[model samples]
Target chain A: MPARKSAQPAKPAPDSTRRSEKSRRAIYEAALALVVEVGYPKTTIEGIAARAGVGKQTIYRWWSSKADVLMEAFLDLGEQSLREAGPVPYAFPDSGDLAADVKAVLRATVDQLRDPRFEAPSRALAAEGVVNEHLGRELVAKLMQPSLDLYIGRLRAAQDAGQVRPEIDPRIALEFFISPLAQRWLQHTGPISYEYTDTLVDYALHGLAPR
Target chain B: MPARKSAQPAKPAPDSTRRSEKSRRAIYEAALALVVEVGYPKTTIEGIAARAGVGKQTIYRWWSSKADVLMEAFLDLGEQSLREAGPVPYAFPDSGDLAADVKAVLRATVDQLRDPRFEAPSRALAAEGVVNEHLGRELVAKLMQPSLDLYIGRLRAAQDAGQVRPEIDPRIALEFFISPLAQRWLQHTGPISYEYTDTLVDYALHGLAPR
Candidate 1:
């Protein structure tokens, strides 16, 4: 049900594009803040509209549901982080040093996870996704899959470069790098620091078994 | 607050022990079911007492709060799972074949995660823990630490056996094995299966680098 696809026109007028971008950013910020403050079940289209200072019709015009808006909001947040980091969208640096590249990207992720602007809203949405199956699945499909694809792509590159073993599944191997950090951040299981994540990257890539 | 040691006797007489065990089991079932049905915030001592058909005094006689009751309930659940698996209490097996033991334990965990009786109640508590920092910390300290200790103990044994790298931190290395499965289970990020966990164990034990 979340897989609705509507192709937009190849190009829009310059003014229209700018206006649309503005509306989109506003909607994202509003949706994230509302969910953080009032929680998921209580956040609504009307609330997002009112907070964003846009009419209900404008939001309804773009996204079908508040879930859709929040998903896109998160996607935007990732892109914004990338832009701030002075990268072209999202790309795992292929410096040909697999371990260094991974550590660099994970460090960036740690910054994003710790960013006050991102933390509360992300936690709120993530909390809701835990209990709400439909929303949870949609989140995986929209927000998470892209980031996962980047990991897959990087691992594939590593495989080609003979850095990673060919027999290893990129999907599973990637989890060894990210999931530990995620668990610490989400569950307060342990302290997350550069040293901690750097250690995870090393342990994951080099194997816990002896060299 | 979670560290408060109850003044109750560690081991009561046989008659009282039997009576206490019965009351404890009832409280655990009531707490798990109530949290699943109504969630953590709404679940109260009085509610658990009413649902378990036990008096409020019965709950207070052993545990101090609803949080304490829920924590013990999860511990009991883990112990029950261990008993069913034919393990004495709860422990990670050390057969000197680290891979085989880890795989077996992980597979059992996969089964437990998928169990309907375990899933709902655990999710209910976990969902609340995500948003409530105080409760989340308490849950980790009370419920999660014991299982984590088992993992740490096993890793230490592995270190002694030379199955693991001497320099690796057991705490961090354990995350590579446990956190991925946990993230997938808790966040619905991906499918959880025996094959998946086995692969994780293999990846963590062996370096992902070209051997």
Candidate 2:
């Protein structure tokens, strides 16, 4: 859940760029707040504008729809999360230990998932996505897919190092590690912790059967 | 999901018991249909009664809340799913090959997930559970926990037979096989298939690392 906010200003006059940035932040904050308060169905662009202290036309000038605004807002929040989480720098750390590296990333993800600021709104959007197929796809494509691609890159690196099986599909194999955590977080199926994630890394890399 | 439905008859008089059974079946069908049509929030006892061609008094006479009614209805649907699928009953097949057995069951689950009768209403209830924490816990405790216990039992059996490692937590280990499929169904992250599930079984048991 990392953000690459793409709310680019068409032309950046210095003062105007500062103004646009301010407005963008306000809109992102307001959009997330409204979605949490009213849910996806009732979260309208007008509502976001009202909460953000901007005109609906101001929102329309930037984002095409409520979905676009919320998506970018979430992206911004993810970047904010990365910033707050300190020098992690939003990239998978490769210390040449696949288990240690994956565990580090997952532990950070656990922190991100547990962060109170991210939790409620993330749940609200995720819950909405369960029933709303189109929005769900967008969530995966924009918010989730990037992180997934990163995992794929790291896993491919592991394979080249002869750490992971070369024949394994990183996409599917990655799910063995991430999906369990995702499900527990998403479905209330179980509690998540650093220990749980570390165990997942160990389990994913080693066969469950007797060695 | 297993339903140990508590929709028992107050009186056991022969004709009364027969009538109660008929009403129970009608209520289950009605509740399931209503949820799929209008979702959990809009589905009501009154609406279920109207659809099932029974009295609201009849529904209330058995179940306490819409959540109860729907949970029981789903339990019944699960049982119905079992019967239609085969005469294996609902028990996990203990063929002594843990991989083969789990693969078979997950494949069956994939089929059931795709079934028209189960798909819409299951999605409706699941979507509701995602947002409603109270309902979500009830979903896990009542509907999901029983089925999970079955998996635990099977894994434990595998442990005793030297199939699964003894130190492994069946609970977490089970997630590898189930959560991926659950996430796919809930989030539309990917398509589910027999081959996909079979691979999940294989990857889960064997590990992602090179042998």
lDDT of each: 0.85, 0.87
Candidate 1 structure quality by residue, lDDT tens digits, B1-211? 1123556576669997787677778889999999988888889999999998899987887778888888888877877776786746456888998889889888888989988888888888888888888888998998888888998999989999999999999989989878999999888898999999889999999979987
Docking quality class, candidate 2? medium
Best by TM-score: 2
Tens digit of lDDT per residue, candidate 2, span B33-147?
8887777889999999998889998777777788999988998888887887667877888999999999998998899889989988888888877778789889999888988
Off by over 4 Å in 1: A1-23, B1-23, B54-58, B87-89
- Using Cα atoms with residue i matched to residue i, what is each candidate's TM-score against the true structure? 0.89, 0.93
Model 1, residue B138: C-alpha shift (Å): 1.5
Which pairs of residues collide in model 1? Answer: A207-B207
**Which digits, one per residue and each the tens of the lDDT, describe model 2 over residues A52-77?**
99898888877788888898889888
| Model 2: residues with Cα > 4 Å off, grouped in runs | A1-14, B1-15
**Candidate 2: TM-score?**
0.93
